[model samples]
Target: MFDSLQDKMESAFKNLKGEGKLTEINVAQSIKEIRRALVAADVNYKIAKEFTDKIKDEALGSKNILKSVKPGELMVKIVMDEMTTLMGGQATGINVKGNPGVVLVAGLQGSGKTTFSGKLALFLKEKKSMKPLLVACDVYRPAAIDQLTVLAEQIGAAVYKEPENKNPVSIAQNAIAYAKGHSHDVVIVDTAGRLAIDEVMMTEIRNIKSGINPTETLFVVDSMTGQDAVNTALAFNDVIDYDGVVLTKLDGDTRGGAALSVKYTVGKPIKFASTGEKLNTLDVFHPERMAQRILGMGDIVSFVEKAQDQFDEEEAKRLEKKIKRNKFDYNDFLQQVNQIKKMGDLKSLMGMIPGMGKAIKDIDINDGAFSKVESIIYSMTEDERLKPEILNMSRKRRIAMGCGHNIHEINMFVKQFEQMRKMMTQMSKGKGMERMMQQMQQKR
Candidate 1:
């Protein structure tokens, strides 16, 4: 997401690439480039200057102390630390620790407030094992309740809305009561938002917060808005004093100034970040990992966390047994694909690996790639999928016609599937393989 900023920061660090040590001349040159990069990303000019000034001091202070470290490496470390501090030093957990925790969400219109509510509901329900109820309080917008209802249904969460009540504060208060009596452990009240910050919107949200006394109040903003997002956060905080910030549309934010600057400007932690439209695409904002990603170092910790989140231990055992018996067929392959899909977008996930973001930055990797492969497998008959070896030339032609693909494409897929099965079968029985399986099982 910080692609442009990463590129610029890399260029800045290149100034010290061949320098044996961090000198004032080289450090100042690099700092100047870094300052320009931040300003170009829409960060406040004063904050950018102050940030680079700190980097200069740190670099100069470390020049003689760390002679073993390369100047470029030392500069990267300095910038990463300062960036982390700018973005709230560490991850902050949402306060959901009440009888029925009440979370009041506020933001501008089209800031993805509703979408984030649904994602948060799903996240709390699945990850934290909390029964979350999504409350629709956007009474002004047409069909806002319906939109929230659809999202809640998709996530298997209950929606509490008073379509006729009109008063958001009343709707929020009633929703919390309903949640308490209905076993919903968390109540997320999605308040109304305006196209821009205005008194009416602020007053309504402030009243709702005063009425419900939410355990946690969050202000969601479109990260694509750049510095405006930070200014909006300040306005919301002045009235509602939100506990944290939520940065939405982060995947589309190539410069990522909002994420880097909001916390610094508003004095609040970025609680969550919404990358894509998928409900599962919401992530708890981790400043350290984000700094690592922005520095082109990748975020392996987050990558593994996503993997473990989607991992099914019992299912893995079943698949391992099948592979050991050379029975890893189309069905198993399809199931594995679905599991990966659950882990979020392929390109974004791959970017989490160390050094992979730069490698595939220009590549277009999407779900459509797997969809083509899935369509071919879906066209196969039960027997053919279970035992692909039984497919003759006539059967192949029929399968190709079914999936709207050519015979050559079908043949290529079959060959790849066979190769995968053989390799998995060999690995399933290799030395220390059982130990690896046990370790995976233990994680569950």
Candidate 2:
């Protein structure tokens, strides 16, 4: 995610931790580095200065304090606090409380507005048990409606679109009416985006707002736009006065500017973050977790919550039992891959573990990593998946040709799978080892 910023922040904190006593010169040096790192991360110059200035003050004021805790640890606490404050300090979730609650989606072109809308609808429908109706308000783009429809279908959410009606306001209004009639509890109107802040775009969104009177208006901005995202968010907030901001494209090589400064700049809390194109890749914005992530520490709580959401409990229990019985095989491996996919992209999953993000930062990880294993598993018959030991040299040769892979590659995957199976088996059979492993992965 913000790997560079994380590294720099950790380095800055390192200046304090190893020192026996905090000194004015060393603290000032660390603060300077911290400011530079924030600037490099695309944070607004003014905000970055103010943030570091706060850290410097805190470091100096609390000098020679907390004898048991290192100066660096205390500095980390200060930086974490200031970083969290800059990013809204607290997690403010979307307000979808009204009967037939309304959520208005607004953003620029290619900001993933439509996808976020669908994700939000599905989130409310599946997570909150609310019947959601997705209203397509982007009448200008011919494919916008279809894109929303495809996403809605994938998530099993209902859609309300009018290709014949060019007016988004009327469509949104009528969709709410339809939702009311059908007992739908949530109506999310997905509006159009502009290349920039234009008069026509603002006017159209304002008209839609006036007509539907949404319970929550979300301004979706692409985090990859860097400081430009903060500027655009300001413009949007000035026009529609949105309830919250939704930062999209966080999965990209975003410099962390928008996330770190948008709320402070626009004076609106970021309610959600869209990490990927997948419908289940949305996460409620949390300032503390984000600050921890920016500081190079992993977010295990959010990661486990994501696993809980995407992984089936019954299936996980079954796999755990299989591991305990030493029956974890290619079938279990395939199931685990599916479970990971259900969570989101491969890189995003790796990022959940603290140090894995740094380790895999430059690695070209993709679904291709799973391809050879999947191919080998598919090459095997059902019985082989159940019992992998049956594949001797001759059997492995036949399986290799069937999957169009060399024997070496198949053997490599099989070896990794075997190692993982053994590890899982040992952990499951040991007393309270699985929890410890989970904690270790969470820390990593």
Candidate 3:
């Protein structure tokens, strides 16, 4: 996402490395680098300068106060704090509190408004346990209604659309009334967007807001647009005075400009961040976690939260019992893989772990790897999946033929699976750590 910015920020911190304490000379050098990094990431020069000035003052102010702390570490702390403040200091929650809360979504064309609408519907449905009604108000676009309908179906949310009704305000009003009667707890009206900010688009959105009187109005923008995204957000805010901002396509070639500059420029908290195309990839924007990620310190808290979302206590108990009995078979392994897939994209999930981002930056990790493993497992017979010990050489040959893989690949997969099963069994019995210590002692 912000790979380039992360690398540049790391370089900025390296200026303070091996120093005894923060001095004006060294702090200026590092601050200059930080300013350059922000500017390179498409942040406004004025904001960057002011941001670095605050950082410089904090660095010098804390030079002697934290003598025990390393110069590099202290500078990192200061920058992290400043960055968190630059973005919204705390996470902002959407207000879906009314009787069928109305949320009007406004943005430009191709800003991912419709897709984000779907993601938000899914998020509210699954996370908040609210029934959201997706309203298609993009009457200008010919296929917008169809796209929203498909998304609503995918997320199992109700969608309101009037294909013949070109008036978005009327459509939105009717949708809210429908939501009231249908017992929908939330109404997310996705309004029409233009190729650029124009009077027609602005007027339509404003009228829709006036008609709906939404509990929360969100301005969605494409983060990949860099500074233009911030400018667009400001424009929208000036028109409708939106309650919050939503950054979409954050997993693309984003420079981190929009996320860092939107709140500062438009005076609105970032409510949501949409990454990847998966409907489940929507996340509530947390500034502190984002700052940590930008500074090469992985967002472990978010990582744990994602895992918890997919965690199944009963399934874990069943797996633990099976592992302790040395019966963790291919089916269990496949089920575990599915659970991990539900956590999000493999690369992004791994990036959340501390020190793993840089380690896998150059590696081509994708969900396709999981597909290969799944294909092999699917090729196995039901008996083979239940009992791993029965797969001999002849069985391996048959599986290889079934999965379109050679004998060597099947053999390697089986060997790796057996090793993993054995390790899991030992771990479940609390002997894996002891065996590792013994091996280390032997090596010594």
Candidate 4:
């Protein structure tokens, strides 16, 4: 998401290279470049200036304190610290601690307000084990209610909607009472959004907040809007005085000015970030991890957390036994792909690994590749899937016709599968890694 900004920041740090220690001239040059980069990313000019000025002061102050550390490295550390503080130093949790916690969501139309409501419901239901009731208070649009209903159905959460009622305040209050009666611990009130900020919209949302007295009020903003997002957030905060901000559409936000400037401008922490359209793509905002990401240092902590979330201890044991016996077949391969799909988008997941983001920046890797393999595997018979070795020339041609692919594609897939199985078996035996490295070196 911060691809351009990352590149510019790297260039700024490179300007300090070959310098023994931080100097006024070198620090000023780097600071000017950093400020330009931030401004080009759509960050407010004043905010960028202040942010980089702080970095410059820190750099000059620490010149002799850490003589052994490289100037470029020290400058990076200083900028990272300032950026973290600007984005709200640590993560902030949503306030859902009431008997029936009410979280009122307000945003502009098409800001992904309803989608985020669904994601938040799913996150709470699956991760927090909370019974979240999705309240469709966006009574202005009939489609809004239907959207929430569909999302709730998919997430396995209850939806409280009064389609006939046009009063959002009444609907929100009623929904909270319904939550209390249904034993739902959390009530997420999805308020109506307008195409632009207007008095009517602002008053309606403020009234809803006052009527429900929600434990947390979040303003959902589209990060793709750049500085406009910051302005909208501030306007909303002035009226509703929201507890936190939810930045959506971050996967499409290349500049990332909203994430970097929202907290500093609106005086609210970005509690969560919604990336892709997937219901499982919502993540709690971590400023330090984000800073590391912007500086080309991948967020390994977040990467591991996602892996642990998708990890199945019992499934791991079963897969380990199968791999040890060389019994991993197409079915197991398909299952593994499905599990990885649940982890999030393939490209974004790779970006979380150290140095992998830049390595695959221009690569077009998508789930479609996995889907092709799945189609091939699904075309196979039960016996063939269990024992891929049974597939001969006739069997491959038949499978190719079944999956609508060429016989050559089938042959290549089968050969790759066999090689993968052999490699995995050797690794399980603790002898393949060294031999594999030797073979790789020889090929090089």
- Top-scoring candidate (TM-score): 1
* Of candidates 4 and 3, the better by TM-score: 3
lDDT against true structure, model 4: 0.90
Residue range 47-80, candidate 3, lDDT tens digits: 9999999999999999999889999999999999
Residue lDDT tens for model 2, 194-253: 777899999999999999888999999899998999998898888899999998889888
RMSD of 2: 2.8
What's the candidate order when arranged by decreasing TM-score?
A: 1, 3, 4, 2
Better of 2 and 3 by lDDT: 3
- Per-residue lDDT of candidate 1, residues 85-197 (tens digit): 99999999999988799999999999999999999999998899999999999999998999999999899999998888999988999998899899989999988889888
TM-score, predicted candidate 1 vs. hidden true structure: 0.97
Predicted structure 2, TM vs. truth = 0.93
Each prediction's Cα lDDT score?
0.90, 0.86, 0.90, 0.90
Q: Please, what is the TM-score per model?
A: 0.97, 0.93, 0.96, 0.95
Predict model 3's lDDT versus the native. Answer: 0.90
- Candidate 4 residues 185-280, lDDT tens each? 999989889989999999998899889999999999999999998999999999999999999987774697898999999989999988888899
Candidate 2 error regions (>4 Å): 311-313, 432-444
Error of 1 at 429 (Å): 3.2
* All-Cα superposition RMSD per candidate: 1.4, 2.8, 4.5, 4.5
